[model samples]
Target chain A: MHSDTKAPLALKLSAIGGLIFLLAPIALIFLYAFTTEEKSYQFPPPGLTLKWIGVTMGRDDVWQALGLSLKVAAIATVLAMVLGTLTAAAVARSRFFGREAISLLVILPIALPGIITGISLRSAFALLDIPFSTWTIVLGHTTFCIVVVYNNAVARFRRTSGSLIDAAMDLGADGVQTFRLVILPNIGTALMAGGMLAFALSFDEVIVTTFTAGNQSTLPIWMLEELVRPRQRPVTNVVAMAVVLVTVLPILAAYYLTRDGAETAGSEK
Target chain B: MTSPAIFAPRSGVLARAADWAIRHPRMFVFLMVLPIVLWLGIVYIGALIALLMQSFFSIDEFSGVVQHEFTLKTYAELLRPSNFAIIARTVAMAAAVTLASAVLAFPMAYFAARYARGKWKALFYIGVMLPLWSSYLVKVYAWKLVLAKEGILTWIFAQLHLSWLLDAVLAIPVVGGNSLSVSYLGTFIVFVYIWLPYMIIPVQAALERVPAPLLEAASDLGATPKQSFRMVLLPLALPGIVAGSIFTFSLTLGDYIIPQIVGSGRLFIGQAVYTQQGTAGNIPLAAAFTVVPIVIMGVYLWGARKMGAFDAL
Candidate 1:
């Protein structure tokens, strides 16, 4: 807030440069999506067209992958919300034995590198005879997704004073009534923010999905395969541009709902 | 956020159960925690334990079947020079990325934390989150295109008469390659690009929390601006820096797809693990390989925690 603390000219320039470095590649996706050159990248397109969008839309496999990703993200988000809210509700007020370790356990999925989570879940599936399927992907996603919800929910739960619940109970409300009238409204936006963030993570997850998806293709896995083996390169860019636009909505929603604007950052890794 | 209408005051058995759960706080807590404990503890922790166990089991070199008996064979494989090189390469790249990310992130984080107000702050956040929420694979793939020999970066350098500079850099030994897309340098660029936001958000957050008065206090004590920054700001922001580096470093260490898409044919730890488990059916070896990052991140996090990074995180 002080004049002396203002960033110098060099610092301001570097900040702009840094932002450009981050945003330029995302801009490149949109550029290439309109490129007429189908097979390889060129510095500037020989020509420009919107035909790849139509071509990508025509691909059946693309539709299937999109459908699968939506389904998995939806299921994972719901499961994360349930488990995360329960854990938060229990953990927010309790100082039970091993509480620190329990909190660590809750965070472990997001804390460790995703590869560890991926392979561990892959092995556990083999050990337990769970078939590689949509449900398998959902489980892998839910493991990490829970932490996002837990992070958001627990913070809100802590902030929502104990007096509100007590006040509701003293006013002759039953347990369900107190929960419905008092607790739900207080924590609803936090849970919404958490669920939205969870959905975004699940929708775009690739590394963990790589291990658990077996032969199935979520949208990210499909995009990865397409990049590795390009059938129509421009189409991939088009699809990527579309994915970026679609996923942006949920992230924006999460940012909007969280009371602390930066709350969505809690489990971003 | 769901309807939860099932818990509505309906009737007999369900009503009694709800009433009972409400009456006993401890019992309610136990019941509430039961599903989470089972899901995280049994399913998630059980999976981790399974991985650790598999790392102790060896593979049959002849039949290709996994041997159930406990052995040091897989961990031994990790010590083999070829496998050890992969670990070293991944760790080196991870370190470089984290360092570069912190350097690049700091100025932006500083600007955002100190000077940006209202709409500009919102725009700064959106800039970070847009890249993050966008498809991870797509971002990596975009870099591949951008760094291709025929890509715009080359075009820009050519336009600026800097083609010789790029060629000179590309002529260097290991980090160089036929093109930027296939170089170790390229892998480093992509890693730094993708993980920079992870670093910025934390560092910006940490910086924002340090009151302006702290800086004024240092200045008021006759400290030069540079001295105040070194003495007062850096230590205060260390935790946030460490928190961000943990993500950048760990993400770089464990990523397979970036190297697969953009780097030279050399294997990173992620690729090694992926191939061993996915293609070669060497489950034990793959599990053992994973232990490298787990151990590295574990030690790094422990060190970071001691530096108070947990507060920033």
Candidate 2:
């Protein structure tokens, strides 16, 4: 593309401004984590200290919340992988009645407001007399996480060749063998990316967890409580910084993994 | 990989079961879809139906218990002046947020889609996504700090001799409060900040679909750059914009926490539902309030489908 066809200077500047708007608040969280002043958000901190980091680490509730979040994300990611991959295979490779409706059903959990999912599950649990526990949170997380993995896996599955399975079978391979040798390897990265995204989503999920988690506190819920009733402002900031790292790392890893191979093959079209 | 498959017993039960599944492909598909069906059907659809049922039921006013018999009494309550204000305010806020995000996101998406090179493209992806995937609650809280009375924004305005400018803006009528942190404006800003990336991704995707060659073809056929953008580019990006708007609009309509943390005492629909169920103990009315977003989004999505927005999404 020529300079004339490239993005105009004003447009480039506007994009930079947009990026700054998106990032500045997150950047402030990291900055304020080390602020010496505990009472407020200061322009330039009176002084910088590592005090909040130690304070946040010593808090038992923070650790417990973090542990619960990690546990829920792990379980939800595994469940989503199985459910999402199977559904994706069914939708992508087979001709089924109401396939489009099934696809729409998978997306609805995510596309709707989280509060609706939250309250609906809360009421359903009430009606069924199912106690709200870690499993309830897992159920809520899996409901939306399935969409992430299905979107990834179905795209990859469509791009994958059907003849590869036929060729494997022609070489005297059974269904298990064909899937093990052909399908898994082919869709593995996309599945991994999907799983990673699902994990990240579950890690930081708050609104649904608020309704489904009866007595449990995930990290985001913990942060919410702290913000509403702050013991020390910077402590939440430190936790927020850590939460950013935990969620962002997997998403970045997913991006890198997906951008290179068959994972993004369908999207490029 | 080959060794495990080769060493597996050919005539064994596992092999036979796999072979059986292969032979009955329809059954295989059914089995694959069965768990998803049960999960979604029992959990999602059943839950929705339950909510709808609760909405039709009325609450005993004095006893404060849900009377589960079918009635339109709760929905009639939704039309009450106070309850209707919550729905109207929430819808208005959601529409404003969606429009602001769309206006702000278009140029950025255009830049990323059109001219970003390898490293820049990677930066654009990670940059938008990092903020996107981070803890949403934390970002909203961070906005509280940024917009607080003695926060960095005020400090910046003071440094630039623009304190009165900030004051003048905050001195307005309905939306204003004591400060930005407690104003409706603050909630609106935080909402746009949080959901802005949802708008960006799809629009960038749509714009990326309009390849360079196509634009060049349009220009070569005697169209100016502006004309090419209007005639060639706008049509391609509209679906993506509409797609992003669905996310921004619906997410805003359903959010409760932002108003609690950052706004004035006005209630959004989500907060109304939350408090009705939790604090007010009015489950029936809460269910009725929940239906508002559901109906709005159902209609909005159906309309967008007609406009072919889901293709970009």
Q: Pick the candidate with the highest TM-score.
A: 1
lDDT (Cα, tens digit) per residue for candidate 1, span A175-242: 77887888999999889879988998899898899889879999989998887888778878889889
lDDT of 2: 0.87
DockQ of each: 0.58, 0.56
Residue B143, candidate 1: Cα error in Å is: 0.8
Pairs of residues at least 3 apart in sequence or in different chains that clash in candidate 1? none
Q: CAPRI verdict on model 1? A: medium
Q: Which lDDT tens digits does candidate 1 get at residues B1-313?
A: 7676544565777556767777687888887888878877888899898887889999999999999999998899898999999999999999999999989998898889898877767778878888877888888888988899999999999999999999999999999999999899999999999999999988988998888988888989999989998999888888899999988988888888889999898999989988998889898998899888889988997999899898896
RMSD of each: 4.6, 4.4
What lDDT tens digits, residue by residue, belong to model 2 across residues A47-114? 99998899888999889998999999999999999999999999999998979989988988887778
**Model 1 lDDT at residue B211:** 89
